[model samples]
Target chain A: MIVSPTRRRLLIGSAATAAAALLGGCDALVDNQHVARVLEGAEALNKDLQRALLSDTTLAREYTEADMSPVFKANGTQHPEGDAYASLLDNGFADWRLTVDGKVDRPLSLSLAELKQLPARTQITRHDCVEGWSAIGKWTGVQLGTVLKTAGLNTDARYAVFHCADKYENTADGQYYESIDLVDAFHPQTILAYTMNDQNLPVAHGAPLRLRVERQLGYKHAKYIMRIEIVDSLKAIGRGRGGFWEDRGYEWYAGI
Target chain B: MFHPRSRSVGKPSSSDVAGATQKKLVFRHPLLVRLTHWMNVLCLFILLLSGLQIFNAHPSLYWGKYGADADPAFIDIRAYRDGNSIRGETRIGSLAIPTTGFLGASEYNGALSVRAFPSWLTIPSYRDLSTGRRWHFFFAWVFVLNGLAYVIYGIAAGHFRRKLVPNTNELAPSHLAHEIADHARLRFPKGDKARHYNTLQKLAYLSVIFVLLPLMVATGLTMSPAMDAAWPWLLDVFGGRQSARTIHFISATLIVGFVFVHVAMVLLSGVWNNLRSMVTGRYAIEVEKHP
Candidate 1:
């Protein structure tokens, strides 16, 4: 049997990927939540007390053209796989719907077309990845608040959960998911994005839809969003915690 | 004569035992460098990994959105169909991954559910961070002191003034282009001189020593609310705590990147020669005889 270099690369990549899947797949491998929870709480309290003390910060430091690193890689869900994903892929996600339901008095299921009709925001922001890389790109999207108001947010609703099709981990309990509070939900720049760098969001860029929450690190912006649930609490969600990644031993609130 | 600290374990005197086995990696790093580098590396890695978990909480970056806890949430905290904590839902608890198929899986946000880790353990030991912080804080003195000593020594020894400092010529376009082409072609300078860092390596080492390391230390110190109280302008330096964090990550990334390139270059140039010099400090070569 002959294996070309491209084929060899593919095989090696798949093997490594399989190894990762298996490790993450371990049902016995439970999510270590204790210290993670404490750290989250500590970080929350810490940042809360120190929230943007730079409120008076003058202009952000300017950088020379030579300062930007030679390369800035795209991160977080560069691609979404699966048949459900493919179907969404077929027609450019024209039929796709982002569901905003739960405690809201009015549950609205809006399509890509309907969301575009709402007020949109565009900003050139630097994405700081937790993996130690940063990239600056322009993202355009509808303010999540606009969507919530259009759907009629309930006074009781206190948190919003974003359901993504990408499974970071699989268990008998359920697939993965993530969540955040309404303050971010209503932030002026917070949006359910459909475009990146002025182009329709490519699949490599969480096409169809991706969340853009500027305040937090890159991971908070869950890509491949399939549903948005507005509820009064995080308890009902996976692990009675907030998100899928959180369920897997991540900080719940990664501000900045 | 070199200072007492500068008394390098250089060429051994004839009186010393030649048969003695080599000592381990120099604790020459001094108490400070050892503490700061180790502590910084530790704190940084935890911050990075756990920060990933936080990002997992919500992986987006918006213009005005600040993924904050101060504001209200969209989910209901009280309303429970089966028993999912609805509001802010203790977003902190979300970090625990449960072992599925074993017990009642906890609910996330609402409707969405996941397995929970056994209530007893956490992945990152809180003790490690606490100790690491202490070492980091106290050891910071060591790093700063060692750095100061090295700087003073470099200047007094004329090492920095002679070796590390790039001449104006180095910054010239033609010189830079020559350097790049030489690098691409792997046409390195010869002998023990080459064994040591080249102009590029010297610049990189000098930058890490003078620039990135100090920035990492300052930004890390800026993160402390206690420290910030005494020194608010620290925040101004990097824009804010978050910005400091971003800088910390960026600095560490650069350091790690430098390490990768440094190691690669060492291996590429001449592995044994490079390793032996750093280890034994006696690089073997025929010293050319001038007639």
Candidate 2:
């Protein structure tokens, strides 16, 4: 059957309108709180499945020096905007100390030189960002497990939360923070990286120290680390979502 | 002595008239196939939209071990302001092409918005990467589960062996040429011939089932850091995470292309009949009457 030009135009227009309505409906569905909760279930599933499949000791692939990217992009906060971090930066972080408290047998405070003195590990690994980019760099630091052991982690400490100096986007609740469970916290590759590419960690790339949870995405690897809080649960942390990006609706367990 | 080709010439049911051309209802798609087919349709639709939304977060693809803003990109979609007007451009390697209305920049909520793949094509229809990711991952699980069910059912029911795999004769050069010519002329099979999938159809279905879908899943897993730790071979298999991302995008685009062609073919060659068969598992085919 032949469709007249005007009739065809009307049909096309209606189809377009219907499609737009459908998309609008999808937006509504996405905005629904129940739907959001249902979708969030996948994150837990992913985490559980990944942990079940891979051993706690299974390391992320370590690349060679040649494999490292020529320029590693420093994303999120380049330089924390505050006099507190600025003064610390000015003094070369000599006075800066990483306080390891919360659910710990020994509430220890260690300086950068002291951290360096306590067994360091250097490894080259790929950093995968949530923005769909990757950069390979050599990281040198004391393993988080070593640090936790030195601080005497309590048996009830289930999660290790990293509090950073930088405030991402300079928002009220953007004090950059991240958390990882005991499985990642004790992983050999999980380190408080104090150096990148054999040099002291650049300010743009989280000066002083950064948490390198290699198995997780970049957001989980909180930079500009100032403190480590060992906790039994993430419920008391920033918005109770475990991390800054998590509070902003990003998945807490970003295994995928 | 009944000929194999003469199966359609057999006795007709009571509905057949003496003078009118004979028509028979053949049970084509089984229940499992129909169920899975529709489920897959929904899964794929959600996946594509949500995936595009995720891709818009970066709007570029790269290769090798590492890539970012500092590193060169293989494909980049960007928008720039041009004297009070905004222009969108897509760059592939060194070549840049203006793609204003459809990609890079497009109309969102009645205003020109800078985004890759436009608002209408995305799940949330806005620049929300978090929500997009939630949708993508949720539906990804659904797609994977649906695909696994389909494959298992296809294998157990002999669906692949009985229908999808083409015989040696159909694979012959002359037969392939003939089929290509027939397809070019928009000539579809008829009568008993239509009862089975044509060689091209078999190849297309098999490739999608075996090659494209598996590649999509594998490359997708490669992009995950935890998965990489679990299965480091995935990184080696796809070159690297960035390379895997590129491959994932390419595979998804191919799937989209496949959908368009598949839909057009269905519409072109007996849309209602095909639709009914898929829905109800009964297909109507015309049979020539013997004198």
Best by lDDT: 2
Alpha carbon lDDT at B142, candidate 2: 90
Docking class of 2: medium
Query: Where in model 1 is the C-alpha error above 4 Å?
Result: A1-41, A52-72, A173-176, B1-218, B221-291
Weakest lDDT window of 10 consecutive positions for candidate 2 chain A:
A1-10
lDDT score at residue B7, model 1, on the 0-100 scale: 22
CAPRI grade, predicted model 1:
incorrect
List the global CA lDDT of all models. 0.56, 0.89
Model 1 lDDT per residue over A1-256, tens place: 1234787688669869976664444222223444333334455553564454423222222233343333335565666657888888897887788888887777888888988988788766545554323555677899888888877877788888988877665565455566778767776667888987668987766778888876565677888888888877788778876876565545566552
Q: Which lDDT tens digits does candidate 2 get at residues B1-291?
A: 223323342556334565555655678898989998988888888989989998998988999889998888979999999888798999999999999998888998888789989988898887899999999889889989988998999999899999999999999999999999999999999877988899999999999889998998999999999999999999988899999999999999999999999999998997766877898887767666557
**How many residue pairs clash per model?**
66, 0
